[model samples]
Target: MDEGRPIFQQIAERVENDILSGALVEEGQVPSTNEFAMFYRINPATAGKGVNLLVEQGILYKRRGIGMFVATGARERITARRRELFVLEYVAPMLAEAASLGIEPDQLGQLITDQLTAGRLSEKETR
Candidate 1:
């Protein structure tokens, strides 16, 4: 969880992570806002805000009388969204920095490959 962001966002990300990691499958039951509050020691409203974010994103859905459930294709949606975010948030910056440093595109690609081959890059970089 990123402390720099709002707690609600972090909570939403935790749920997304669970979904991405296969801990929360499509159509699977998710804990209620109250349960989330109890488990994370956060206010119920805060937890609800997080859960609601997922609901808004179509990654989760309410069951009226029951609690939430993972929406169909939620994992794929989350993965696609995260990949887009990664490019905008990480890849773009790396490319911009490399350009500023006069690093050619091919050179940067080779550098990335070399790092991967040498196991110098982190897991995220390899990805």
Candidate 2:
């Protein structure tokens, strides 16, 4: 739980992460709001609010008497939305900072590749 963000938003993102990670599949039933509340030690209404956020976004659906389930194409929808956010939140800022530092696009690309290679090497060493 991040103290900087709303608990409901965190709850919603946790579910989204689970779906994206394939831990929650399309049409698979999700835990009830009460279960979420108990697990997170939060109010049931707060948990429901988070779950309802996904429902409103068409990422989840209810089946009358049954519990909530992941919506069809939810993974693709989440991926598309996240990619857009990534560009806006990360890529745009990175480009702005690079420009401010007089780093050309080619230099930035090389820097990124270098960092990726370093990261891979570090991961191998840790294994």
Candidate 3:
């Protein structure tokens, strides 16, 4: 993540990506705010901010005595939310940039697809 982006936003996005990708599933437990703070060596307040972002988005739910858990529809909700953000933030700008650079949208998309495929294959091979 770019340093210019807020740290809380980055942390929130990371957790959201994990949930969307099924690393964090519906009804599954998530690390506590303090745990996240310790794990990332950041202030607990920062971690809480990230976690609270998820809570506000209906991604994580409190369990009374227990820690936070992913919401029942969290995976789908995360996916849809990200898809919405991608269109509004990533896709539109990238399309505009492609036009500005005289690069075909299909070509740029192919490059991204190739890079992602190669990245996954490399990760699998290494594992």
Provide TM-scores for the models.
0.91, 0.92, 0.73
Between the candidate structures 1 and 3, which one is better when assessed by TM-score? Answer: 1
lDDT per residue for candidate 3 within 1-127, as digits (tens), equals 4578877788888888888777887899999999988988888898899899989989888998899998998888777877898899988998898899998878998989999999999999999
lDDT of 1 by residue, 1-127 (tens): 4678899999999999999999998999999999999999998999999999999999999999988999999999999999999999999999999999999999999999998877854765869
User: Candidate 3, which segments miss by more than 4 Å at Cα?
Assistant: 98-127
Candidate 2, 1-127: lDDT as tens digits: 7899889989999999999999999999999999999999999999999999999999999998989999999999999999999999999999999999999999999999999999999999999
C-alpha lDDT score of every prediction, in listed order: 0.95, 0.97, 0.87
12: Cα error in model 3, Å: 1.2
Poorest lDDT segment (10 consecutive residues) of candidate 1: 117-126
Which 10-residue window in model 3 sums to the lowest lDDT?
1-10
Residue runs of model 2 more than 4 Å from their true location after superposition: 124-127
Model 1, residue 28: displacement in angstroms? 0.6
Relative to the true structure, candidate 1 reaches a TM of 0.91
* TM-score, structure 3 vs. true: 0.73
Two-way lDDT contest, 1 vs 3, winner: 1
